[model samples]
Target: MDIPRSFTIRESTHRIHNPLDDAKLAVLGRALRPAPGWSVLDLACGSGEMLCTWARDHGTTGTGVDLSATFLASARARAAELGVADRVEFVHADASGHVADEPVDVAACVGATWIGDGVPGTVELLRRSLRPGGLLLIGHPFWRLDPPDQAAVEGSHATGRDDFLPLPDLLAQFGALGCDVVEMVLADQDSWDRYVAAQWLNTRRWLDENPEDELAPVLRAELTDAPVRYARYQREYLGWGVFALMDR
Candidate 1:
């Protein structure tokens, strides 16, 4: 009922699980302008940041589902800290096929589209919990520039170049799925650094504290290699964004 220990350790300090910074998330909140008291359903909502913050800032109520017990604990704490404990709920469950008991004003699956296999399947899954005319928020990656070869692709954490489409093709994908791209907030190289670089520090700190832990060697290796990998490939070739979509 939990994510891998390696993943939890690597992201222990992250409030948002994706390549989005708090400012970009705030910008997205303002752009969406979800009405006060609207309901939201967030799938694979790591740390429940979106639900907790939206409940605090927009007067929205919501439920967030994720399999990470560690992240769910953080999410519940954040809800209480934000004074939105009653407005949002965090569930420890598989998000892949989970649908809200009631339809919601906004449904999102940010950065975990693999829960539904891929973009098309994930989009359909999100729609199952959305009310008529409700918004869908999808967080996905695109190719800022085509990778030159397999090394670049692997360094960017993708198995193949086809794992991400170029920016134009990504937007076109939404249209093909019968959705209109309403609003989007993109991550620049700095945002990528903020997200990926922080993991190195988290890993190093864990390794320092628990030198004999079973995962220490793995973390040490990652800490040593991740910076070079990210700077060379991901920073240049991978672009990520959360796009607001509506039925066309």
Candidate 2:
């Protein structure tokens, strides 16, 4: 079985499969207030950077699940490098249907809410893996200001049939799921630039090393103009954030 190419390639090259920034991660870790030895689940965990970092910094145990074998391998290597192999484990499996074997103190679906339909459904699914009153943190995009065009809509991860909710709608969904939005941190324009620009550089580096690879053309196309696209649409129109929710 293979995960989507875009995600797998990005994971192998960038160590992050999703479009989250460091500022967002820090905000999430803080919002969850992850205590030492807490059990955590990271769904669609990419290369498991956030999970490994949290395990190391907070003395927690984490189990991360993803569909990408490449990402799972990378996660394993990262765990070993961080000397947290014993504290964290990664599984190569379908994230959308996977569940923790046991309840956890924290459950997260950062940048992968689509796994459970959307933010609301994903929130409910993640909560099933959390103990009563436990935390569920999610990373999602919002609009700094409402978009005015098709390019803006595409850049924001919003399109027809995929209704991306604004921040207030997100909070309401949290409420519907019987959770309270306790904390949130927004990704500013600089952070947005960092996230997008980093992708271009990483893609270019990969292309440079593998000039004959099948993906070289795709990488070239992206490298040629990703920065411009980001500056015009994504960085300009979208606001991304990591939000922490708890039992109301």
Best by TM-score: 1
**Candidate 2: where is the Cα deviation over 4 Å?**
11-13
Best by lDDT: 1
Collision pairs in model 1? none
Residues 1-248, model 2: lDDT tens digits: 65867545544565655556655675567666789999999998888988888887788899999888888888999999989999999888888877788899989888888899888788878977999878888888776677787877875656742366667877787788788888887778876666666666667667778899887887788677777777777777777777888987
Task: Kindly give the number of clashing pairs for every candidate.
Answer: 0, 0
Candidate 2 has which clashing residue pairs, if any? none
Q: Worst lDDT window (10 residues) for model 2?
A: 7-16
Q: What is the lDDT of residue 21 in candidate 1?
A: 93
Error of 1 at 62 (Å): 0.4
Backbone clashes, candidate 2 = 0
| TM-score of structure candidate 1 | 0.99
Off by over 4 Å in 1: none
Error of 2 at 96 (Å): 1.1
Query: How large an RMSD does model 1 have?
Result: 0.7
Error of model 2, residue 185, in angstroms: 2.3
RMSD list, candidates in order: 0.7, 2.1
